[model samples]
Target: MASSKSVLHIITELGRGGAEHMLYKLLSAMDGNLANHHVLSLGSGGPYAEKIRALGIPVHELGMRMGRPNPMLLLRLRGLVRKLNPDLVHGWMYHGILAARLAAQGRPVVAGIRHSIYKLSSEKFATRLVIRAVASLSPSLAALTYNAHLSLDQHRNIGFSSKKACVIPNGFDPDRLRPDPKVGARLRAELGVQPDVFVVLHAARFHPMKDHKGLLQAIARIKDRNMVFLLAGTQVDSGNPALSGIQDDRVYLLGERDDIADLMTAADCLVNSSWSEAFPNVLGEAMACGLPAIATDVGESAAVLGGTGLVVPPRDPEALAKALVQMKDMPQEQRIDLGKRARQRVIETFSLSKVASDYLASIKMFWMPTAGDGPKDVQEKEFLVHVRNRGVYQLAGRSGWGRADFAHHDRCGAPSWPR
Candidate 1:
């Protein structure tokens, strides 16, 4: 038996968002015999820290905060990376990519680009700078995995390395997220929602990008008193001042929830109103629960639906309202059939086990061979071998993986194949 390789995952934070949840789900689905995993958060560890720890994986925190960059953390990160000496360093987002590039110290580093970029100027000044920097440094990376094909195309258009880019959409576990009428009934009873009332779910953190205001406006356009919208995520409760003036009797603000699967089971349909997204995890989770969805045509949303649900233009409240009405007015049997097909789509296309295996395969491509097994001189060289088109390209140069040397080596020789 071969020894399990080490993988270090660095993310912007450990918050309860799509990226965070995906990381947790991926870790749970991955085969432990192949690799040992460790997670490092550039910012404070949020809800996911303990959840990840529960799986027996070590989680480290840098104690950084939003809009605040700490230079001292670089030294700490570098020291930690050196200490871990992981076979692969996987950065989860733009900030994590920046940190990974800065601290990898000639180690192989792969990046996860999780968001969509429609326009560069629309981004904050700081974020724009980071994007430019990441783009400039992208050419030498061993690999760049995107959660959506749309995100990969958008980033590549903005100068990200197309050669190293690949798409790996988000995955869902049907067993954990499937429909349960009993659980749905229990949830509705607890929430005081009548069995006949129509429930529309929008589960995402309260952020400008999520466009909670747009969702609220769309719900307001509807006159159906029996229809209620359930908003669930971090800071998405009644206490949020931004939502105060618009929220009404028909709107239920559910603060951060661990029982989203139950909520999905209870809801009649899911709505994703975000103007931007790479691959919204909640949509798939809702689908896995056998709930139909209505979403904006953003970042693989329509593709995920695969003709199973409704798709509308982004930031269009009237269209959203119309879709809501359309979904609500559909015959119960037809809607239930759609929900069943949606669940089947998730099972056949986005099973967590299959996606986790893809992730593991991508990671292993850059895992270096044991030192003595490779040629002595080649073992001493600090570089990552990227296999593309049957050729091996050196991914890391002297200072960083900022330059690539397209030199193919015999697969049977030293550093024959990545372990």
Candidate 2:
């Protein structure tokens, strides 16, 4: 039966942030186009709006001015909510969470907390105000979900409610992200990286939070001249003054490219130097693409790795350099084995279908209204671990990972992951 329930997603913006990517993935991965989905962004929808629209979903932008609150945003959001009358409203990040809470009007509203509260000082003043606001107002929301277990605890320490909090890790499509030899070759050729070079990919915008300088120091320590660093993200190119110290001939700056999945294909490793994160998707993405990773010990990074890659302390360039050398020195067979395990970890635990099922289950737990039955059906049919010990990963024609409906995998049956 077509579910009567529709979900409205509210976010600060539909930029390329991890939260936006996850939201897009969630809606796209819904089985049978399950629940009717709509999105409202407080700012311009940005590049991702078109991608989400391509999925037959509608996206609304409130044109809210960033770095400052727009009081009228509430009025616009309230009107939109009344018109759409969604069965549930889900908010992403602090700004969107409070806005959703204000507009829900006693209806079921769930908030998503995607950033790690590593320290209160890490938050901007505007966001700090929202965090404080939510501290008192979170109880009104039906439930709150943290992308990382660490984020949940950190927020609780800062006086956010723990009474109705849960963790739902981000999900990925192994099929879409797995290693492609041809794609990798094409990417390397396009980037002018030599066939013999050991390529390490770093993806993050030019922000102090990313600690790009730490990574540059680590790269300097790597003795191999054949080593190449492919830097991506907004303003991560040589023209950025922050990267002026990077005089290595092998350093290739790709300011911002949409085909990150293709770049992941060509990468020998993915490095994340973020000082704080909730659930950094780049490491998981690299793993999904069958590449080893070296990431700082930020929010859920080590956890996300699942022993599939190396994790070092944040802001430690020496340790990161050592890890790089270790990776470069490892035998190709051993590295390949690690890469295989990395891919397996993503497939087993973080596949888009599995995480989507968990999300749907959480929604069911929060609100039991009969109107919200579409995702409930998906949770039962596609994400089941076992089928009478026949040993399969997902049901035929409903895996929810991609357009393909009948893909299956062989593995011992486990609750969250069978294969």
Candidate 3:
């Protein structure tokens, strides 16, 4: 196997957001002898900071706050980038993407576009502005990657080029998250949930876009007393003022948890009430844990469910309530079978190892150009190669492989392939 290359990942924050959590999963999946990765966050360190350090991935914080533009942030980031000089700079989210572009300094930058724009109203004005700026500068990147197909088209429809876009769907680790009945039973007992109770999980931060209120409304409409809602994520606890108003005794609040896989395993079903999303990380995680999910028809969620669960339109509590009830009343054996199918689908198509490898395959070549590239548009790569005197060989862009530059040979009889 080829040796791992160094990559510096830049993100807006190390917070427990969808994008951040997905980045963590990617790092964890790609970690080992074959992956050398570091992290840089534009904002203060978050929950993932400790885990990242545990993985031996160095983390750098720039102390940039949202809703404000600090010019000094650009200089600091650039300084760090120049100092580290990684093989490629991979930026996550909009702000990170823009910073990566500015700090690339001739290195190939990979900008990750992780979300779809459902409406301008949902975004802060400053965030919207930064997104607009990133849109214009997006073409400067070696490749702009999107996890969801909807996001790629949503941006491309507004001016970004489809040609420059790459799709690498999020990956889940079955080894890390698999069905565990013992853990599930213990978790239920610890939570005081009855064995006969039907547990539904909603694992996401308390954001307006997550439609927490809508989910609450749907649950309120459900008359089944055996139904218990397990809300887990940032600010989903009793101390949160918004959630404190929820007086339903059946609702169990678990603020931020590290053992989401265990929670998913204990749950009878996973429900997503987000108004908009990129790829629905919670749904994917739940699937990896062998739990069926019910998600709104947003982003690529409906496609991801793959007939294993229910799908309802966003912002419709009645539909969601109906879906929840439908899932609850399912035959015991049938639900178990559905859960098995969900796990199988994720393992076959969205395993974290496979997804991590795919991401590496797509971005690895950006820094190291292989031999036999036809024509090189990038002038800096014009160094020549001699593969046993095969008529002055250069990397060729044949069949769309864009990095072929060879006019002079410094090392003759080197391997035909650029190591």
Question: What TM-score would every model get versus the actual structure?
Answer: 0.88, 0.87, 0.87
The segments of candidate 2 whose C-alpha lies over 4 angstroms from its true place after superposition are 365-367, 370-419
TM-score order, best first, reads 1, 3, 2
Per-candidate clash tally:
0, 1, 7
- Predicted candidate 3 versus true structure: per-residue lDDT over 299-377, tens digit per residue: 8887777788899999999999999999999898988898898888888777888778767666655655656663233
Choose 1 or 3, whichever is better by lDDT. Answer: 1
Model-by-model lDDT, in order? 0.81, 0.78, 0.79
Deviation (Å) of 185 in candidate 2 = 1.0
TM-score of 3: 0.87
Q: Which candidate is the best by TM-score?
A: 1
Ranking of models by lDDT = 1, 3, 2
- Residue 173's lDDT within candidate 2 is 96
**TM-score preference between candidates 1 and 3, better one:** 1
Between candidates 1 and 2, name the one with more favorable lDDT.
1
- What lDDT score is found at residue 393 in candidate 2? 25
